[model samples]
Target: MPSKSSARHAALTVAVVCSAASTLVLTAPAHADSVRIHDIQGTTRTSPYAGQQVSGVPGIVTGVRTYGSSKGFWFQDPNPDKNPATSEGVFVFTSSAPKVAVGDSVTVTGTVSEYVPGGTSSGNQSVTEITKPTVTTVSTGNEVPAPTVIDSRSVPSRYTPAGDSAANGSVNALTLRPARYALDYYESLEGMNVQVKNVRVTTATDPYAELWATVKPSENRSERGGSLYGSYDSQNTGRIQIQSLGATADFPVANVGDTLSGATTGPLDYNQFGGYTLVASELGTLKSGGLKRETTKKQARDELAVATYNVENLDPSDTTFAAHASAIVNNLRSPDVVSLEEIQDNNGAKDDGTVAADVTVNKLIDAIVAAGGPRYQWRSIDPVNDQDGGEPGGNIRQVFLFNPERVSFTDRAGGDATTAVGVTTVRGKARLTASPGRIDPANAAWANSRKPLAGEFVFHGRTVFVIANHLNSKGGDQGLTAQYQPPTRSSETQRHAQATLVNTFVKSILTAQKNADVIALGDMNDFEFSGTAKVLEDGGALWSAIKSLPKNERYTYDYQGNQQVLDQILISPEIRRDRAFSYDSVHINSEFHDQISDHDPQVLRFRP
Candidate 1:
């Protein structure tokens, strides 16, 4: 047996293999450059097959765990193992499936990966092999300890902005077919817990430069007047996310077929169109058992609880993601979870004579951190290719910004760190990503039905998520009102449809899962009390959060001189208790907009 190293490295992160760490041996007939990790916490490893199909070329699933589905796991191995470990760091396969019994070690063929961030801890890398290895039974492997995978499935589907996938079948490609919404039942589950597996998602393939993520939830009925549900719960219909696969980690797919093992910490939630889904939060797994505080118990401040704000269309140059992030980071009235719209999309642009998205977005993360934003990092959509045969401005739009120490998450496929909201798409899979003359025609079957841009995140230890967004603008001011007067323009029709879809989605979540803490916010492209506003309010959801506040404190964005109330922060029943309030509408990049874009911004204050 090769002595396994247990030296704990702390640079990067990677996925785990089984319960505890283990010692692994690679049998290669040729001299191959390999890495070995030693003293990995306490895990051990060993090679089951010496040299057959795996040929020591670094491939195969060495272990398996049952979380909920038969998914794969990889131990982030940086260097090859040559010695013994002080502790153990076995790759863990969570609880759910057939189950990995004590002394159960299987030798298979696949690619072993350097521990990845989505893995155990830092200084690690993860491997998602192209080919899966065959599970060859071996001597009963050492029984390694298991870590907890606290579930977050019931956090409500309302927070998943316009691109998360589900099994509800509400949408057919980019378009949605109509039926009895069952909208009333979808409300109560807003903050509950559920699981979504194997979700294949899509997003707006718009080849634009604006840092935007426009989402639409449902369709058909609410097409008349816009609604907040569509905007807030846009991605709940199980569609495409520029960056994510669907519903966090494709749980529905995992749930339906075979799976490892997984559970829920919050209430379980499901949709008519989708199966089960939940918000992402700190895992209860790998319990350090050291003075840890549960986020679910985060207290609400007495003066002003932290509120959520969605700054509409806040695109600045790539150089300002971090430093400029602080400009909006510290809200005047203050908020715990500040939901921003139109962050900064980095797809493809000639920055210093080099095509770069990470170059700019990375700077944003650095700047925000330097500004003392605290452990705040970012995730993005790594667009397949945004080169010409492209749109004018490097086709990129995303939503990202978080207090690192305050939240934890896993990244899916996307562009840059900030613009990960919009991934490389084959077509306009969203609210029109690849429009005409841009990157060729795209998949816009659900063009007008874009869901809100969102992710499963945690706030103050509480398992909460945000659906940040901005919808189609009121294209032009005129020609809207042949049937309806003000707020109606030809260009605004699609924009209004965006509103209707959002409204229905939000209402559905609130109806399905009551007693949920949800916030449906962003630029509705219209004013309050108008079509979009009325529908959201009539849905009984507004009664919980924002409506719970005094009227004067509701508006987030202001107009020229009059208070048109274009931006807002709507909430659900569970979150209404936070006593949320409006901070102030803003113009973070006044100089830029003065130089480029249009829309202003909105800011809100929170107290949790």
Candidate 2:
């Protein structure tokens, strides 16, 4: 027993209310008051951060710091009621952790008091005994919305009182803003369909994720593609739960055979692929407010060029894109617009179970330049941070290719950012789980999964914008066959989410730039008649090019005993005005799957 003063110091208590999720999570105690500590006399757990939440569950440390000959360092638990962070938490590593090896999903949680002199950082303000989060282990409840739908105009809205950092940052390090939570960035809204107005958010720090958006009336009444996907985002950075922006499509609603007008930002006409030959033009902000549609010309004589390829894990081991220099360039053969799938970001090693693929996007640039396709500059990708997808995801793969020579990126993040916030509809709810994902004291989820990358692309002289993507493979099984079918089981919602992400981007873009030539292309991971492709066509998202190709020449991938279509190039009526564009799946990689990648490449050609 201690005196009054000492009693007050040891008064912290912790409790964990069990939930449907397998594990009961722990919240840190109030600041200043550290967890109590005491070295266990005899136990095999000789580590320093042991016996605390850092051990995999939330608990009070026995003491601040304990040292033993072989046991090394030791930390006492402050709260006995709290368990460790998780079973395989990413924290509590045995050696000095390097900054580069911080493992994207690897985050330590605890009090960020003054450093312990010999600690990692100077005035670090993070928890000492951090246990990195895991994707599988850190589960949530009812994340899937109970299917539902609504008109684009009936959605609701909430004002998030602005803060000092609310304003967009400078052009150099544009502070990419995350989707507003008050707007419902990640709450379940399956039954409530909504339409989100497209908003443009430019920042220097966040170039790939400059735009953030929300889908109002997020629910739907039926499974129709348009209705199947109310509104969704790929970045999963945050959710914007709000009522539909009372907006509707009025202009001769852009559809097949329709042309789109061009967008003029300043002195430049913006893009060439747009104009009368273009399809549904996206023009507005997906961030907030209602997006009003504007009907425009339906016919243009300009031809547009588009291409989609299954770069087959384009990420090379050494992070060099030059590996395929011969195929990408010298190959004009090199497309005017290219959409690549399987681009990766570096986080950590890929051996064992850590998904943090060492390959990153910079390699893509190098490869393109090495292949001599440097004429096409840089563009945008989906996920803002590659560490851990905003949602409960371990792998962090994204897409963002650009052509500085044509369209210019206004709001953009410089390199990589760990902040949870993003611009407009460009980045919605984060893919990471609601909670930090560490399951134990050692198992930190590494970032290493691939997701589609969609962004505004300007067609030089044509004024058209393209939305690129890479959908979830029907799970990428080697046993896939022409007659094979797997209903959203192994990777059901995974692919669906990819489609939904694509739909949201298209709708938002059209809302903002009505009649702008819009192109949606990529390796959809599904065939022509697959549910994934149907959803895209049904939503009037794109006029798929393969629909015109003969059945024998339609496939871009064939392996095991099956031939399926994985790459596609679709265009909005705005970008497909008349016969201005022609597209076909290329067999360069597919023919030599073993030598190159496993998927095929699709190319589109149009006269700007």
Candidate 3:
């Protein structure tokens, strides 16, 4: 058996009492040696008397967890201790459904145990519980404890404690300073009934029947009605996850900027998905935010339109092709040229020695035409087997799709999947020697990463160089819900290095020709406000087109409660100086629950 101190912090704190077994009203006086629920919960995650047998634990039954494998009930002390650090409630875990009723005052005799939900190997937190319980009814028809009121003021303004120097620095430690950090505040109330009133939805409802809301409105709010998600800032301190404990059908479908009018009363619980969640039995009515999807941009014949979309690992066997093709054609309005990312090998995820993506690309083209769009011709270089980092055996790579009638690809010889592409000056203009070639394929920055694909295209006698990229992803970065204060973005170092290489290549093109029409676009995998993006925008060589939008509206991806920017299209100095470019974040996905991809495609129309 593992020691209780070694377990992570308790995620759930349920306290329950035994009900009357017979019709006879049991009237027994409280025992003098009875242990309080607050003492069992203590100020820390592990119970003070863990692994020891305790008798006469008294409380009123509050809730019953009848469904799950760890069937248990929650009980709370009617008169809680005045200490803010110690919680007044705890969970009693039983092997079977607890035969208890709300308002039943009972004394429990059980062995205190620290129950890890997913076992020791999962790295998940444990729930402090009392197992092998024997219930003895002390009295019947007792009043339930009043719920603690929670609002902006009750929640601390600080999002997290200071580094390890602070008293409450350790996230798993029981030393909670509820008055200082919001995480500590929630931890202090773990498993206790709390009420949140007049909250605004910060994120759209997820498929798991949950939504995030802000207790108090802030200045950085979106027009759609939710708080704008700041990057690890204390401004998002009051944001909390709201989960419906009942049926998924009982949960209301809502978008950001929506309102939950009445007070939502629930127990404060912690889980692996979201750090702290309010498991609500009573939910407030949802009011619409009046948010609507944006209209597709109009295409002009005088200018050429280019788009970048991450199809999310498209393969010949996947059924999402039709939906993605429909989005590209109907939602994005069929740009003259499109830079596609995450195109998988012909066999999809099958690890069979297949490295070709021709079948996969053809299926998407056929889907585009079938969806009432123009016929699109594709060009790409097959990546080395399992060298590019993505799904195993998927061999995901970047490809370009263009309408042959509108824009023609300037394909030259000597370009393969592994070889690097070189830039040359032709007729006093900078161009790629190979129409579709990899840029610095052997660069250490692109180790186990997708190489940038450079393609030269001509639309109406004007030459434009487009570099399609799928930079390093945020795979190994610490999660926002991690146990660390201001979690580190470990993947950014690689992305920054990748950005440097792309910036160097763009500088070479500009050095050769002062006013080259260059457009770099794709899923860069870093935010527009991130340092990785700054590396790509150094010295005015390229300008992030997404920044052209208003500060509140600049987002192409939505994660948690934040509408953030991950995919971007950066243009050269000539394109930005002319002021002849217009761009739109075609909002066909990312906001809705049934999205074709996690990202929304971006389109840029400019007169080169």
What are the C-alpha RMSDs, in order, of all predicted structures? 26.1, 25.2, 7.5
Ranking by lDDT: 3, 2, 1
Cα lDDT tens digits for candidate 1, 526-563: 65655656655555665323344334333333221112
488-589: candidate 3 lDDT, tens digit per residue: 677888889999989988998998899988899999988887898889999888989988887777777776666778899999999999848898887767
Better of 1 and 2 by lDDT: 2
Winner of 2 and 3 under lDDT: 3
Residue 127's lDDT in candidate 1? 18
Error of 1 at 460 (Å): 5.4
User: 603 in model 3: Cα distance from truth in Å?
Assistant: 1.7
TM-score of 2: 0.40
Off by over 4 Å in 1: 1-323, 330-336, 347-357, 380-391, 394-396, 410-451, 479-488, 542-561, 577-608
- Which wins on lDDT, candidate 1 or candidate 3? 3
Of the two candidates 2 and 3, the one with more favorable TM-score, higher being better, is 3
| C-alpha lDDT score of every prediction, in listed order | 0.32, 0.34, 0.77
| lDDT of predicted model 1 | 0.32
TM-score of each: 0.38, 0.40, 0.85
Top lDDT model: 3
